[model samples]
Target: MRPDLTEPLKLLAVRVERVLEQVLPTPELEPSRLHAAMRYSVLGGGKRLRPLLCYAGAAAVGGRTEQADRAAAALEVIHAYSLIHDDLPAMDDDDLRRGKPTCHIAFDEATAILAGDALQALAFELIANDPGHSTERSRLAAIRTLALACGSQGMAGGQAFDLGAVGRQLTEFELKRMHAHKTGALIRAAVLMGAELTGQADSHQLAQLARFGSLVGLAFQIRDDILDIEGDTEIIGKRQGADIARNKPTFPSIMGLDAAKAAAEDTRQQALSALSSFGPEAELLRDLAHYAVDRPS
Candidate 1:
């Protein structure tokens, strides 16, 4: 039977929240509105899956959760920034996020954009100046990992593919490629960053972890696509059928719902397979792979 992750996940999430609170600018600071919007965009909502993956990755390499905190915080900040931009009027024009008004909806468009930009800059700053890093090289590696994930070849590139693919029929391979960058890149970074921070995982172990992260990332997107079709807006924290409404390409749209579900499971199995070399140390990572598909939202 799978170990119950309810308590562990909750604890890790709280840890992330505390770290974010410490690192993010207080709403009372000068440029108060921008600071408030940044805090609002980051603080109170959404599943902190990326950060959890970072912790799990560290654990898989026999590192402690405390050691992974900076990387975890940085990943979530980047994620929050991405969500803010993705919800803008020029993008998805989303009104809801984490069941609250999106940044652009809660604040003016310019403020929302600035909030995202500031958060993006802050993410790198956190990673670059992480005092926990034993060596400058390790810190730089973490920074490079995050930068590549957020840059033209990673999440941003994937979003570009998504925007361009709207209302167009794409092959399964093409769809997977798009999501691989958009959703998978950051997730991969989270896991890799966790392992990298420890300075423990050798290249071979890192390779296996990367494989695990990639498969789990694909599973995550497939489950999200399925949820977009079957989940209630209140439960999923976003508009149900939003993808269909936008005619966005999705696994379900290309392969059918049942097929998409099966694909998610298969991808989850592949993720587990990638961890075959690991022992009990990787149980948390395995549980995360399951959670990626089994989560209700």
Candidate 2:
């Protein structure tokens, strides 16, 4: 049985929020509108799952939360920037996010675009200047991990595949590869970044964490596909069946709902198994694996 994560997750959320609030520029700053938009995009919204995964990875290796904060903050900023860009008219064209108006919808399109660009820059700056990093090598490694994850070969590449796949039926292999890059890359980076911050994870340990990240990443997208089919538009904060409307290739669209659900379950099991080498300190990570599949939004 899964351990209860309610209190622990809430605590982590609060902790992460504090770190974000400190790092993000305030609305009073020059270029106030843009700064405000950036703050609005990052604060007081969404599940912060990526940061949570970062924290959980650190915990699994018996690392302190403080050590994970800069990485978590940087990754979350990148995630926020991606969401802003993904919601643009040229991309997913989403109007709503987390049940609120998307950045482009709430603010002007140009400002929204600029805000995303700034946030992306800030993410790298934070990683580069992180005082918590014990060495220049570690800091550079983290920066490289994030850059590769968000670059054309990773998230951006996946988004390109998704755009090309609309209205076209893709094989399961192709679909998985697309999401692995699009949705899974950053998630995988989050886990790896957390483990790396500990400076305690050995090669074998990092390998295990990588496997866990990959499994959870796939499972996360599979669950999102399921929700697009069965979830309420209001609850999901987007149009129900949006992917279907776009004719995008998703797990359920390719394999049927039952099969997609089974796939998520199988992936979840694999994620859990990857943590077998970890001790009780890994309970948060295990709970997060379950949350990835079980969350309603």
Candidate 3:
């Protein structure tokens, strides 16, 4: 049996909205061109899953949700930047995202690239320069967290792998490995950042949160793989067959549909187990485990 952790997942999305409003700059301010691009992309909107994960991680350890806001906002910025670049003509050449025009389509490709670059820098600056976080040391650590998640070892590396894998046969493990870096890295860091916001988290508890993050992170990709096959573009927002069209290796392609669903279930179970030590303290985390896989997109 598993704990009925429902609230943790419920609170995060709302919190994410507040965080975005707080961190994203006002349009009236100077550097208006850059700010317009920054707001255009970051505020353009998506699921905001990464930010929710950050709050969930903090809440699991009894940290205040507001304390995790900066981290969540920063992660969203990085995520938004990745999307901007991913849709460029040189990359996926995607025209639609979240049911709207891609940045490069709505704006110019050059502007889109510049906006992504600026948002990446802004994410780091948000963490390193946040006064509310209360300590330069902690802020610096947050910077490190975002850097590793977004850089060579994480999102960037994942994209590189994806680019190289086109029209190739990749094993299930290889498919998993690609997503682990591309999407999972930042997710894990989001959870850790939540703990960091609380001043300090017990090492044992932190380990458990990392485990929770890892399980959900992978599950997220597996579910995504399944959805790409079975979901509609209306709900997924992006085109449904894009992965197949690109010849990307998906769980369904390698493991079969039933196996992919089973894998997602197993990952969700493991995610729940990771929060066992938190007992009811991880209620939101528990809810998220179910929600992550169950979500249509």
Candidate 4:
């Protein structure tokens, strides 16, 4: 049987939620509407998978959860920002997220746009100003990592591809490449940023972690595609069949459902293989690889 990570994951999620709350601006502050929109988009929902990956990455490198908290929160903030923009009328035009109104729906489009922009800024600020980083060099490196993941060659670029892919037939390779940036980039960043903050991983270990992250990222996206088809709207916290509704190409749509499921499992196994050099400390990450593919929503 798999190791039970229910308690540990919950605790780490709680830890990161506290950090997010601390860093996000208060609704009572000036610019209250923007702050409220930001908080609404980020707080009180979702699986917190990216933050969990950040914490798990730190633990894999013998770093403490406290050291990873800010980075975890930063990843989650960036994720929230992406979701906010993705749900805008110009984008996916979704009405529900986390089983409630999306940011653009709950607030005006302008406020939602500003909320996403502000949250993006806040993610970088959190990393740049984090006291948990051992050195300026490490902090800068972490910042750079996240920046690249969010930039044209990463998440944004992938989104461009995704938008362009509507009503088009794409090969499995093309689909995977698009997701590697759109979905996988940030996921990879969370794991790498966590390990980088620890300042303990050697170059070899970092490389291994990167490999592990890449595979996990792919598996995560594949599973997300599967969930979009099979998941309940309430359970997945988004409208069911949104991808299909948008005519967005997905793993299941491209490769068939069984093939996509197998692909997710295969990538999960590859991710685990990348951790072979690690000891029991990486058990959490290994479990996460399984979770990436096996989670119901």
Ranking by TM-score: 1, 4, 2, 3
In candidate 4, clashing pairs total 0
Backbone clashes, each candidate:
0, 0, 1, 0
TM-score of each: 0.97, 0.96, 0.93, 0.97
Clashing pairs in 3: 8-284
lDDT of 1 by residue, 1-76 (tens): 3423567777998999999999999978899999999999999787899999999999999987877898899999
Residue-level lDDT of model 3, residues 41-82, one tens digit each, is 777467778888888777778888777777888999999999
Error of 2 at 263 (Å): 0.4
Candidate 4 lDDT over 1-297, as tens digits, reads 342346788788888888888999998998999999999999999888889998999999999887788889999999999999988999888889989999988999999999999999999998888774556777788899999999999988988988888899998888989999998899888888888988887899889988898899999899899999999988888888989987889999989999999898889889999999999998878888888887877
Candidate 1 has which clashing residue pairs, if any? Answer: none
lDDT of 2 by residue, 17-113 (tens): 9999999999888999999999999999878888999999888988888888888999899999999998999899999898889999999899999
lDDT at residue 216 of model 2 (Cα atoms):
94
